[model samples]
Target: MSIIQINLTIAQMLDYTMPILFAALCGVLSESAGVVNIGLDGIMRFGAFFGLLGAFFSHSPWIGLLFGIAIGCLVGALHAFITIRWNGDQTVSGVAINVIAVGLMTYLLEYVFSTTGYSPQIQNYFGAQAYRVHLPFLAKIPLLGAFSNLSFMIWFGFICTVLMHVLLYHTVLGLRIRTCGENPKAATTLGINVFRIRWFAVIVGAALAGIGGATLSISSFSGFSDSMPNGVGFIGLAAMIFGKWTPFGALGAALLFGTGQIVQSIIAVTGIAPKLAPGLTLILPYVLTLAVLAGFVGKSIAPAADGLPYYKEQR
Candidate 1:
């Protein structure tokens, strides 16, 4: 491939990587606090639709982002109430949230947009050239050309990865969160409020997942579709496992999966997809996800107290 094609491919890879990176980050934060959130997909769906709804009516992607974050927090609170407050099964709560998101978003899509597939498009948004950042000097530098013109969300994803690393490893709060996940009982003896910490982590993580979802509707595309987010959330969980739950690790894993996605597209665009069996090319990313997980999941370990409910009053 030409240098220009390589650069464009890298750019597309970054675009595809954003949502998965964010989802993996969500998993990291929540599971780090002893919560296993399998509902990342549902949260993304909620964020995608509500984000588009906000942008469609307000004509501002920023406002749409807030809407997505708000819904994420709301749903996160519900999950927290169930799993943390009531000591419910974490897996069940997450599955419930996912189910609710599917039906509720489907209904809302038809009720509001009067369509079953997609919402109205919002112009002059981040998906347009007017809002993308331009680094003219980077364009001529081979691989650096990928940064020449890109959406702000892509930059934000990178920034979030760094910040998440700092938050998880460098700060006191980070240590405490990890402590809660590793040993909630020990955390309680040390005066840490496990429930409160868990609540904060899950909600914040969900907000990030929401932003990931919103990125799809407002930045990656101009509007919300029934297939919005597709399976990006689940793939993110795979990335999380592949990365061993570290911010930078997730970033690398996300990039790998993103490259798979971009390659799939490149194959189709280059007419090589016709030579392949139908639907086989489309599963490239998912196949990559399974391969990574099968190779790494057994070796990677989760937090000791992860997915366990903490009932302080019982002991």
Candidate 2:
């Protein structure tokens, strides 16, 4: 309704968009390199759970963040091993990872903390409020300055997007990764180790998703919960698809979905139609995902060999 309110909404949108941004970037990287990572939800859940566990034990949120990243790498390697080394079905591997993660997190939460829904509030370090970025000079800039209060995760997400773009576009590693996805046989002929390249891409993607998950428990909120991600990882997949597998494109899709979330909150607060707000808010992202995909599905494309198991021909 006003300039201040709109700017504040956009600022909040940036924070809310971080999980999607990170996860979508992960999806883009993995899929661009010919691996389908439907397990985004699983590792995000792992990151949230383990991140809290690490902080709780060591009294350091930074350590928690590292734990999350490590788990992501392990999971990515496992997935890559299953698909790349073993030549297993990629979809089945991804789905299995998600299912395993759900069970693992559920069991750990109950057994370790004696809780079913969430973990105990992490303390001494992580229990502290997630840090925010405040630019002294920028904070004085009127309407836009209100946004300076966003979580540090929001800034991290933006930086990652730029970095991913550079990695996928400018680097020699980027070229090899793309070549592997497009034609592993050709890449192999060109002296690239196709399997290793795919493995590296998958691990890097998972590390990004780990940050996405950690943002939930360590940066956006104080502790982890069974439902910490709440479908943000899946939504990020949709964002990646909507973006046609590019970092900036995925970022735009994340912003669009984030706006939908912000609008949902606005509806509840504004009371334009109080009774319909909550349900509509809950369904907004899903509806948008389906609608956008349906509209653009025909035009959107994937890497030539995405989700296919690659096996080097015997000499």
Candidate 3:
């Protein structure tokens, strides 16, 4: 391919990477804190629905973002209450969230809009908004210019990645959280409230995951659809695992996965092995996920107490 085409592909890959990256970070945050959050899809649904609702009514995307985060946190809190406070099975709780989200969001959509699949389009400042940000200077650069323009949420996702890395590795709260995940009994002895820490992590993680969903409906496309999330949540979890549960690592994995998803489109447009590309693109990420897990199973160890209930007297 030509340099121009390569740059365009990179830009497109980045466009798709934001949502997955944000969602994967949710998994990283949850698992790192000893809770399993497989319900990112559910949380994202809440975000997309509420975000569109807020934006549609107010014609302001910023307000829509707030709504998304709020709803995501609510779902995350519910998940936390089930798994942390009730000492429920984390995986079961997560699965329940996903099921509930699908059913609830679908029913609510039909009720509110009298339509089943998607909501009415939201109006915005750009006359109908495209969820992209085109930077001036970088837009003029040569080979690197393609990297400059992107969805605003992509930049937000990048910022979140940096902040998450700092929060997990550098901050006192992060250290406490890691201790809670690794050895809750020890953390409790050190005066850390394991329950609260887990709750905080789950809630924050959910909110972050909401950004992933909002990216779909608001930042990438300007409306909410029942199927907008489209399994990206599950993909995010696989990315988290493949990245060894680190923020920077998850970013890399997400980029790879995003590229895989966009491959079919690229080849279709470029007319490069159109027949084989479709099949390969569809199965690529999953194949990579399985391969990564198989190759790294013993090498990639999770937090010691991950997914384990932390009862005060467990030790």
Each candidate: RMSD: 2.0, 2.5, 2.1
Superposition error at 62 for model 3 (Å): 0.6
lDDT of each: 0.87, 0.82, 0.84
Model 1 TM-score, 2 decimals? 0.94
TM-scores, all candidates, are 0.94, 0.91, 0.93
TM-score of 2: 0.91
lDDT of 2 at 58: 83
Candidate 3 lDDT, 1-315, residue by residue in tens = 676777788877886888889899999898888999988988888888888887878888888888889888999999999999899999999899899889998998898899978788876621133545767688666778776666677788889999999999999999988898899999999999999999999999999888788777887677888896889888888889878889998999899999988988787778876567376676766777777778744345679999999989965
In candidate 1, where is summed lDDT lowest over 10 consecutive residues? 273-282
Candidate 1 per-residue C-alpha lDDT over 1-315 given as tens digits, one digit per residue, 9 for 90 to 100: 688877888788888899999999999999999999999999999998998888889888889889989988888888889999999999999899888888999899999979988887889567789889999999989899889999988999999999999999999999999999999999999999999999999999999999999998998889998976788989898888778888998999889888776766677666665565546655765666666557643456778999999878666
In angstroms, give how far residue 93 of model 3 lies from its true place. Answer: 0.8
Residue 151 CA displacement from its true place in model 2, Å: 1.7
Off by over 4 Å in 2: 1-8, 123-130, 277-298
Residue 67 alpha-carbon offset, candidate 2, angstroms: 0.9
The better-scoring model by lDDT among 2 and 3 is 3
What are the clashing pairs of model 3?
none
